[model samples]
Target: MKMRFLAHFVALILFPCWFVSVRAEEIKSPQPCDFKALFNFGDSNSDTGCMASAFYPEILPYGETFFHEPVGRASDGRLIIDFIAQHLGFPFLSAYIDSIGTSYRHGANFAAGSSTIMRQNRTVFQGGTPFTFEIQVAQFNQFKNRTAKFFNQEKENSFTKDIPRPEDYAKAIYTFDIGQNDIAAVISQSGMEYSHAVISEIVDNFTSQVQYLHELGARTFWIHNTGPIGCLPVAMPVHNAKNQSLVAGYLDLNGCVNYQNDMAREFNKKLKNTVVKLRSHYPDASLIYVDMFSAKYELISNANKEGFVDPSKICCGYHENGHHVYCSNRAIINGKEIVPGSCDDPSKYISWDGVHYTEAANYWIANRIVNGSFSDPPLSIAQSCHA
Candidate 1:
């Protein structure tokens, strides 16, 4: 009792501003989670640079809106993972494959562009990451094992400057924002019928990775359900809808492909159930399920009302006939080399290049999600510790 009172007295003396809050439990602390680091696994939605480093590096107009140069992110600016890092009061995570400007002091990102829960294809040339969820899980294990060796030898290792502390592993937050590409791949390769039926298998693959993380000493997990791929302009062309050849259904109210959105909705439902099932399996862990579908759907469904152009509009890239020219990519137009380039103001748009969201749209979605409105446990990122 004396120690508790003395600690309060010292706090009152050191900080007199909000120290005298009306109630002890009412304080909205910055990070009640107090997560030491962030370890993320996902696709392009959360990928920082792994795919770019291993495959093709981006150029101008990719990160022009924020970084003023290519930094490997597909968006015009930061992604939701960047915003989540800010909410955690930590620096943005570095890709495990990107060696330059990297410091694992906070954590590392194993996400890659076009990643899927189930293994799809090899390399960006093949159109998706070979680094599937299980592969990323193996990479994470390797990282954790190797970094620990360097940290243990810090006394003799001058290169241990940016390595994460050994203790932070348990105190870190592990996030997953993948699984969209899996459905897309199946839909493109097979048909809508197989994609609809294979959702359970997809969830099963995702669950195995989470179980591995828990076994590897991961305590807190933040899982984001897949978003509305039906709304993406890049995804629209792939849909059999426009031609009414594959799935016979009209576009939804939001001008999105109905079948694609249905796939995302079904995936989210099963993913949520997977989280619930895992919570019982790992009684000592904190598994948080965040509903990214609703949050992203909200933005896409109301892009114009929130001071932005149509959600289906592309801020960067050009479509010449059937060939799509993404931002900073070269194309021969009329027998001339040309880059379609980006818009004059990316902030006014939602989709960055017909696929990913712009920094503005990302920020808007981040604001709504970090507040806990879409979280399964109904807790903000800051308050995820309890959940």
Candidate 2:
């Protein structure tokens, strides 16, 4: 009788505390900045591991700096997208193609290296077929459908609770960092004379993709403009070689190929205008244009000031005669396997493999991009998340 009385006394004391805790939770409301997921699409600039997952025999020297091993990322370390995820308190996005023990609770990365905005069979530098932006969008739709069905099945089976609602996907942040490969392909195939026409076509395709994504419940958009491709070590040698007579006049004082930079600027202008149009059309949505050109140009123009000793020189490459040898883990040179050499300090260099930026450079650019100045709508990504 004494034991039962003691148990009743304890229950009476704890019951009110438990009820109050439950009531407090029930009264709490979700905050504006309480983002639940992130969805990304682009090329190598933001590809976490989509390329690696699609192709086997993962390349080395790609993720050596940050991950300590290759994880299919084009750079030596994390990309700007990775930094964004970290800033938002989320783990790195899992590549959609990664089928082995992957989680979709946070989000998926559909970005692939050498991916183009246009729907074409354009081959990447590594000879792998790219999954274009159109395909990525389709894949996202499929993912959504599959996830919804899974949630429904779980509900019917009484196996799980707290399934994501439709609004959750609509509220998720959608980021795009494509179009570099499209311009590069045009320049490589038909010279800079045809870039303006190609840029128009790319913009049309890009805007259409945004509309399609909006229809699929994406309300927030973060679009990245193409960076200065002409200043790349690989492109500089090619530009100088092709325009030998015009090199002296066209090259910048900093020795970067200026004509190519001019093309990039023109493309960025069009892209910015497109963003304005998108905002006008989708008044309810948050469409932000990230100024990648200015962010990158600042680094290039003030390399010394930014603590980078060599902004023009690539961190990893093979030394050759008046040409920048592309960085690769394994390459055949006269039937001999050759490995590219890397600098002792990659942080002091802007370009990593003649095309992609080093981790340090990406970090710097990401900081600028998220600090509100580089965004067109005059709001940082963090603020947009809150909005």
| Index of the highest-TM-score prediction | 1
lDDT of 2: 0.79
lDDT of 1 by residue, 139-252 (tens): 999988988897665384756678777888898999999988887765565444556557888899899989999889899988999888888877665422344444446577
Candidate 1: residue 30 lDDT (0-100):
44
Per-candidate TM vs. native? 0.86, 0.83
For model 2, what is the error of residue 354's alpha carbon versus the real structure, in angstroms, after optimal superposition?
0.6
**How many clashing residue pairs, candidate 1?**
0
For candidate 1, the per-residue lDDT at 245 reads 45
RMSD of each: 7.3, 12.5
Q: What would you estimate as the lDDT of candidate 1?
A: 0.84
lDDT of 2 by residue, 117-199 (tens): 88775332223345989899999998888677765553443322223355578878899998887777665664456567777
- Lowest lDDT sum, 10 consecutive residues, model 1, at 238-247
Candidate 2: Cα lDDT at 82: 95
